[model samples]
Target chain A: MNELFQKVLAENSILLFCYLIGSITFILGLKMLSHPASARKGNLVAAAGMLIAILATIFLYRTENMSHLGNYAWIFGGLLVGGVIGTLAAKKVQMTAMPEMVSLFNGTGGACAMLISMVEFNKIMEHHPEEMHRGHLLIIVLGAVIGTVSFAGSMIAWGKLAGKIKDKTIPGAQIINFLLFAGIIGLSIALVAGFATTLPVFYAILTLAAIYGILFVMPIGGADMPVVISLLNSFTGVAAAFGGFLYDNPVMLTGGILVGSAGTILTILMCNAMNRSLKNVLLGSFGGAKPGAAGAAKEGGGTYKEISMNDTATLMAYASKVLIIPGYGLAVAQAQHTCHELEKVLEEKGVEVAYGIHPVAGRMPGHMNVLLAEADVLYEKLLEMEDANDQMSSTNVVLILGANDVVNPAAKDDPSSPIYGMPILEVEKAEHVIVNKRSMKPGYAGIENELFFRPKTSMLFGDAKKVLQELVTELKQM
Target chain B: MFQEFAAFFITNYRLITIVILSIFLGIEVISRVPSVLHTPLMSGANAIHGVVIIGAIIVMGSAEPNDFVALILGFLAVVLGTLNVVGGFVVTDRMLEMFGKKKPKK
Candidate 1:
């Protein structure tokens, strides 16, 4: 073989080796991520792979290509800005705000793809304007049109997540949404018809793309964010891959392909969780007008008992064993840190502390766990409902923080309630149940939480974090 | 070494993108399960974002263009790309919060 040919093969081998190693790391990361016990290890493994890949790439780069140095400068600068922003958001966002964060990530990923497509357009226009072949042009136009829609659609998702777009059903929203999608698809087909070089066609496609994005995600609500987030993330991946094709870059193509495929699959999975399709979830205004029924139900079965933080803390302090039950309300109030402090105080008194976690405790899956981890709680202390329920008989006190649904006895007894079969924290089996909540309002599923009205349960109504803090202060006194 | 990969990556352009995006989406799907594993998925995905920092190498390697617009845009992509990479790590670390201990009910 020619020496230059051999050298090229060797280089390819090295890069391929690096890529495989990185891919293995990802697989290992996923495997380890299957449970909390191994998550840290998985993260470390994945990080190691990333580190290796980065190092390998640096080693492979030829010194001859010095002109692309500006890309490095941009990369580092982006790291600085994005890093700060991400850090601040993580630190500041309440546990309850995680769904919103997911939504924002969905938006950001789409925007990044959109921007990548724009850059690709510039590259094609400047370097190979006349050389643009039909296939490449098709990819370019598809990228621009899709990328734009994803970007604006993700923003609308953000709005829905933020409650800026109210849950109220708007007349003709569905028809309008369908028309927008159809029109965008039609324009996209036209865009691929080798007419992209025309200015009016290009601009019109751009307008339609932007509008389509907004309309695409506008009807989605907070309840369906996880699915939307996954779908949009997949869209970003596809867009990125197309951008990679335009640039003839192997890395982008591979990376984009991975993201797009993975995202699509995940979107499907999320949809199944809600027993809906991507189309229905995005267009049907899911969870519409149903929660209002819960609002009304909350008004009935309204037996009342209230307690102050100090009183609640005194009970917690005196108890020899305590179990904390967290739900969406806990996440919403960002009370994890304060709850951690309460855990510490209770533990100091020789109280055995445990947390009962339900499968569907928050808006998104694992919502409660994320919040508790933020408060610096031990991973071992959290027991699943099945595991913890067996122990509830011996539990002296069950502190319900920011929880609404998971403790409701109606799940086991009332056939009429929506959450009848769903397993919950068996707090009723405990000696005492102390629930800290914002109000008597029903949870996302809109069922009245009978736990709130239980005779043994004392309702400490206020903000969850604030009440947790107060309880901590009182625990200190006790 | 990561810097080198970063440079190689930006230079190679799109070689890694398709694979990365596919993996990302796959993780997204897998992580949606309300099981004990979602956090780990996020952490792993985040670890892959280390690829973003390589954008620095790309920025440094690309030529200074005669026309400033593409140059500026390219520069911006690299910068943002790098930010996304490092930020991904930080976010991954935070995601580890999913492993918090649940207090025993008894």
Candidate 2:
């Protein structure tokens, strides 16, 4: 008995040591992520920490009174399959598809939390039917409900973002969604109240929760996808935290709490940037039909002045300072490299160049920054909206490349505009404004840009890449 | 019985305090990230939640062979937890790789 006790003590001490190292590295890794330069290393360090934690749990931490490790085959098989699929998917997914990928992965995490709780509850039902703790039951129910919702909701979000699923509201979607939510809460209460221990009732709660998840995301529009994704991401984290509570695992608990709070803060930041409240985003479902409706009214916009490539080149080359604003158009045209090339050539000609990035410039937050960074653009040259506006009046020329709504003066001047209260880059304040786009077509919000019609603004119409390449050639000739 | 309950409460109290503290710590750490790193930061956080695989492993290790439901759920949880961890970290590394100064040709 003393020998067995010694072995157990040794195993536990080693496990504890691993957990300590893992948790510390996780904290350090997150701290390092504050700066762009250290972010990659931070990720690797945290991954190492996870490796240690996983290994210790598998080999060192023994379950009480077990003769041998139970079912190593299942655990190793899962790790092998999941690792292969995840690595392949991560390697293959394009940066443009990142939002969907994040959503999909987050869904998997939620599914795991849900499954863990279900398994735990099943164990309790079989082995300890006569004894049930209210706290444990409550945590299990919370995990089940939240995890199911996040899983189903994230899948829907992924489908919608990938264009595999259309944004369609069922008749009376709001009412149905509310009813499903109520039913889930009611069922959860009943389960916690010890009404029954049968699997069917538990499964019923899961089904209702899953349906509620689908309903929760069904009405949200593409424009609000980032916020919805972030919100659901937080739900998964919170669900995982409940799992942590149930299992009494500190590392799991810490990880879940970190993700939950971070996702919540990000969601709030996204809402504030878009000038919408969280309630408005969840309940109003505001951006769904606006784009289509506004697209039909495109005929009423004033004609924008056009500019030749030669003129745009001449203006930019002669300018002392130029500011470039990029948006989804740049991403669509795959023009980031060409845009960077233009900046390089213009800089060689003694012109100062920089980029102005709007908070919601592209499909996702920080979309423009990533695209620009991929093209080897200097990080310091990427300015936030406020800072860009601060220097706009002094800028010799403003290049609006594939960007519209964020630079649209209507956001500030027209109170009737749908995006009136949203903050935008004040590109119209620059001395000479040049807008590059495929056509006079409005942006994703489907609203006309009054800045495009300003006397100081002239349009250089073409695909953003082609136009930028042409401008680069013209600048070279000069 | 009262002493046992008090001990349980004390243990839980420590955990609850830790949970609340970690929440604040999470927000504080992420708040320092610039908008430029938001995507990677978010993805990295997504990977951290994959830590729950430990819980899944524990459940599977403790479960009996006859506990089919528990076995299946535990297996599925392990797979999902692994996927989230691997995918999130790899994608984040790929993104962050894009940033920084380019190397000069030798």
lDDT of 2 by residue, A349-420 (tens): 999999999988876788788788888998888999899999999999999888888887778888987778
lDDT (Cα, tens digit) per residue for candidate 1, span A336-358: 78888889988998888988987
Looking at model 2, give its docking quality level. medium
**What stretches of model 2 exceed 4 Å from their correct place?**
A66-68, A288-300, A308-310, A348-350, A416-418, A439-441, A469-478, B1-11, B66-68, B102-106
DockQ of 1: 0.23
Which portions of model 1 show Cα errors greater than 4 Å? A1-13, A48-106, A125-131, A153-169, A195-200, A244-254, A261-286, A295-302, A307-320, A408-421, A454-456, A475-478, B1-34, B43-64, B97-106
lDDT of 2: 0.84
Worst 10 residues of 2 chain A by lDDT: A284-293
For model 2 the TM-score comes to 0.91
For each candidate in turn, the TM-score is 0.78, 0.91
lDDT of 2 at A316: 92
